[model samples]
Target: MSNVINIWCIVRENRSVFSVTIGTNNNIFDLKVSIKDRRSNYFAKFDADDLTLWRVNIASSVLRNKDTAIEPYLNDKLEEPADTIGDTFHNVEGSNVRVVVEVPVTTASVENLANLFSQMNVSGSSASENASASPFTFFTELVKIAPNHVQKLYQDIIFEKITNPEYFLRNDKIQLGNFAPNGTASVYLRDNPTPTDTEDNVQNLFNDLMLSLPNFGKKLIVKDTHNNPYLDRLKPDLSVFLEEDVRDGTCIPMFVQTLLEVKKKKSESGLADEDKGQLIDYMNVLIQHQQLREHFALFLSDGFRFYVMVYERNNRQYKEFITNFITGLRLFYILLRYDSSYTKMADPRSIRFYKSPGTYTNIYLKEFLGLGTSSRVYKVDYNNTQAALKYTQSGNAHHEAQILRFLNENNVANIPNYITHDGHSIIISPVCKRIRNQFRAHHALQLLRLLSRIHSKRVFHRDVRPSNILLDINNDSVVLVDWGAAIRDPPNEQVLYEGTISFASPDILNNNLESHRPTATDDLHSFVRTMYILHNPSKMPIIPDGNLATKARVIREYWDDSVDVKLAGPLWEEMVNAAKNGDYGILEKCCSIFKS
Candidate 1:
């Protein structure tokens, strides 16, 4: 009789549904072949010489080996088996044959088993019913993962889509309902209304419409409408709207159009009697529309009326002011792009226009002044003193504010004091005295010391240069600036290349080092360069001769000029002899040159 070789079968890393089978007479090699045959894509190729098989008991002790073919002895004790056994038989001669095979559980097998079970008509539902239930259950589960604000925003978008289905169907209308919850709305006006039914009237209409709706715990959105394509000669002015509270009941008002006050006044003054009569006729037709009456009600309210005005200033000057403001607030610009609802109404009372402030335009002190690429600096009087202001147009005003706060918290001396940010501009440390070159070395050294200290504290100044080092003349010391590129070392990953080119070491230039891992060696190189520039007016290191010379000559020239001034031309001959014989001992004789 053939000996039965019971074996355990296991499968791994499979994602599909399949079945596994085991036989009492199958060996480990036969099991592998059977599994491969069942799963056509799964093949196990093993070295025949290294193949070893062991039959393990419930306690993980080896019961049998393939090499040692032990025969079944009568009345031998069997190991404790799992509960899912197929059969146990007793022969007529009273011999027992027990078969046991273990099936291993795995992720793939579970998924496949699930798929197979799903296909079976076990009770009531078909496969299609089970499939349909998955999406609804998945969506319910997904809602748990969504953020509250995002969920609210999505609901607002859905509401808008439901209310204005035609707008989406038109294909030309840009759907802006998603952006409405942030307090603004955009609508494409198909036609411009009469003069009386202006943009302000339309805005008032939207305001009243929103006010009519229940509060619902969310802020109502203001609406604006512009002409479709917006390039036509009859370009419709955008109508903006806001809501108001009512005593007993709520009602919606139509949009009120805001016209340039100067143009309106000029038209009223220049009109002839007949033209005035025609204007009256046009006004009568506009006043009759229910949309116009609803909008006019909002115009009557103190907060909902809109008007446009212009100051008697040159357009160029106003443009320059706006440009300067935008340049100073670059971070804010970015913020606006990401989140566009931010708006600040300009106050005419606080406005001031100018050409340029010459004292603030010193090019050499650009870094110290925090003057950016635009080279324009604005000063606002705070507590009776002028403070320099830096603007970030990219909309990270809070980030800039946090950086300023960090500087202040550290009590870092010699740095320009951060004053305040007016949401659009950053007020920086004021310049106390006239800047000069005399403070360059001291400032550079102070900066170096600060950098070394920061590094000792595990900080790296990735952007170290003259521009980032500021001099406070009142204290006569230097303060390191531009923490934008500064970071903690080693573990912090540096993604961008930062720092000035001239002061950046060879490693930085070659992109050989990672960010936040700058060493003291690079700092030392920069310090030496700055010192050399300060000592020499030309700013380049003085090389005695243009050619590569002997070590003796190199030692004599680079060390001390005093030795050559005293000993005359005979040192050249000594250098030549040392070079010819490759004698370093003679070069050591010239060590006295550098001793001084």
Candidate 2:
């Protein structure tokens, strides 16, 4: 019990206190990971390994009460990765923050990068002339490496090998086998390559190649990685990492600046599907932890051939395909392409949003229905007519006003016949807050149709919960509200969280962040869960947790006699299957089940 301690840390940036329950025996690197995970969004672009932890000098200054500018006394730095927390810093029980964290600079946003690239504006002729002849089969247009940079790589690396052979041990490239592995041997051979001369030979070759490169030396080192920080069962052949970033608990992907992936010889499995998959998997983990849009990987397709792989992604947050909808995150590699390729609506700079005060000023607000930091909803008597009015700062991209305008234009049902909006909010005919304990089959069907209509317009309500859905008592339907988190066009990859977690889909909650996107199927899952929440208000979240297995079990066993389970239950199963298998056609059928 003495080994474990609760350490409170203060982030020097915003003076936010970060709490962690870790073992005193645990290294400094473990403590950093705990801090990062606790407030991932806050440090989305930061590498925790780069954070500077100082033993809080409570006797000098404090995080909240800035008595001194110089980072309080006792300024004893927790510098060594091998040193244990308890052995280094003395702990006080909530009397003062025991650790001070210094966050490094965050990476630039994708939009800013896009603007910079547009400013550079490479000519079409030069772009075509400079495109490299890539060895990977499916790889597309890659940004041409500058001739000087390419020359640097060749001179500093290739020439290093050519000139200094005696320093580097010689290996026979001819001895490297050219055997192509089919899927049958993939699982066994990849796991246990003890019998293969090729794998070990290639691994050594990869290590030597990275070691010889000018990019890696004393400050940077080459290593073969094993464990993952992001929970993906992936291991790179060799990772080029900053030596300072490596520790007993440090993960390679978190620190790896560039990774090396290799195959013995040119074969079906080499630069083709299998080898590329590993690189892509690693890219997912790296991008999540590194918070960067692009990374590079070194690929050795054969005994003597090496090619550079550039993994690039645009800023868009939803992915779509004509063939099938892959519900989770999917990345497409292309150089120079940005979110400019998507709809103007997805690009926020172009959207026209009314933010100033509206024309109508004569309004007597009676009762307050809801209130938040930037938003409020109230029952008001406006122009001598009773209306439910809501107002807030606009997040205009697929926002409440925008979505409502689109739905209104499309004539989607349950939208109020009379609705008015101006600067920041909307006024609509009063509707009941939500259906209480008596949620019905008819309401279920109406909710299904409402969501179907929204999806039909390519508008997905990222947050679909009971509060966001109001009952149209007179019409026996529902009005879907709160469109601030909605998105339109699909993207190649998305890295932001836009919706509530408990009602989130398996893809969002699955811990493996390889896939994090909003989908029509995500809505279906939320839609079904919303019905359950409506029927049983006491059992709040319905699922109550985001653990994948437990959520599945809870969803599977959930049955309510209050609503028509025969219609809703089968619909849920079909929708869930569609999400997993990319069978979106089944979604229409899933909705039709409510009609049946």
Candidate 3:
């Protein structure tokens, strides 16, 4: 059981204080739900982990970095007793418990609120009172948000280290500074290299860039214990690994997080498809042994141009991001802005062009399974076992892991077991063969049973359509997959209508589902249409474009009782009526009809 605290938060919104009860365990997603329920429109969309009650309260001036203020009541519980939170607000019985929910970013509105809330701006406030402002709040308000500015600042600092390592060691607390605190910095450069020495220059430049990685207390910087036997494998030109066990007082050689392959500017032409393939192969080897590492960035650079492929081990997906040396230099610094987890995986890789019609060309190391809006599924042959991998191109919004984890926790059946999720990609149970035969009445019953099991656990497969419902031919079982569109059984307002328009419900197609909270009825509607299509493949009509109102009327007409006229047998007719009315009990009643 986790500890939780219920606190009345009086947030200043539109010159009025709106009071809401929030618990410690409630995340930003839950907060959004509460906001919608209260009909408050103060905050815009933000990441789930970004806005937390503990973080916001800690950054508040009233708290003054005091543990006694809120920490006494704070615990890791989903729901805690009222006594644990204490009866009074911060030891004051009648005091107003106020907390300003700052965005913590450089938004114009955030800055205005920061200035307004700053004790320094308040008249008659002493310096001692104003000093109560936490350093975290001040830093959040004043921190620069522009990427280019940050990169240039870091680039200059790293270049200074390259010019005079001793000066950098004495003056700054940058990358090598923390690890080698009392020691002098040794520049990894070949002495007195001439203008003709392109390889040496490239190596030196790469070394500087690697050392520029901000060392935030962890022993991320390590010397090249060159000539090591491990180098025999892959034999990258430059290999940088993060020491994960240093915090335990032991500097153990961990995963190789970054690998670089350098070629002379004159030999740039030598970089072909084979070089790229070799880099990917090296990454595959790293991924197998060093699965702990989030990203294994393989860079092939020819002093100027760079071709990089970052293998995200958790996601089990990789993407290529091409850039020149000049942009690459800035990119390295920008990469540090992300948590080691995200940066350790790879820089952003967008496949916008690949999303367009007829734009997909099979360029894969493993067998391509299928592609969705957010991920491309592939079948991989791994150590004599087969598994499916879903790779989401950078910046595409998807939360398949969250959905799968929920379903898994509830012990939902018929779906694939979640193997691993690496923020970007996911690997699941072995891919089953596609259903070659048209779905029959028996298949519809199996699907209904699967959906009933899923719904029993309070999960709605919002995208219940033919393409998403997979078939496990071995047991003739149906597996409903692509949990990307899955939502809690009751559904949340945030769960938007994301299914195919043709198969979408009349309410969804008409945009009439208030607050966008999808219901089991939506799934049933799609299922009814899916069964109709499977039963009458040749007779099914096409869904046209134009007016959505007209589209809704057409959808309603198609799903009416008369639509069952096209269904072949009595089992389908019963199933059709059940699905149209969102009655799942009929599935159990008709189970015997198909079992025979």
- Top lDDT: which candidate number? 2
In order of appearance, the predictions have TM-scores of: 0.28, 0.33, 0.36
Report the poorest 10 consecutive residues by lDDT, candidate 1: 133-142
Cα RMSDs of all predictions? 32.4, 25.7, 25.5
Better lDDT candidate (2, 3): 2
- Residue lDDT tens for model 1, 374-483: 11233345556666544444333444456556656676555557765544345566544322344543454455456545546565545444344445556776655544
The better-scoring model by lDDT among 1 and 3 is: 3
Task: List the candidate 1 regions with Cα displacement exceeding 4 Å.
Answer: 1-370, 374-376, 395-400, 422-424, 432-435, 440-444, 488-490, 512-524, 537-596
Q: What tens digits encode model 2's per-residue C-alpha lDDT throughout 98-211?
A: 777877522232233323322211111112222211100000111222222322222222111122211111321212122234432233335433222577676665454433
On TM-score, the candidate that comes out on top is: 3
Residue 337 local lDDT, model 1: 27
lDDT of prediction 3: 0.46
- Candidate 1, residue 182: the lDDT equals 26
- Quantify all predictions' global Cα lDDT against the true fold: 0.31, 0.47, 0.46
Tell me the lDDT of model 3 at 415.
80
Query: What order do candidates take by lDDT, descending?
Result: 2, 3, 1
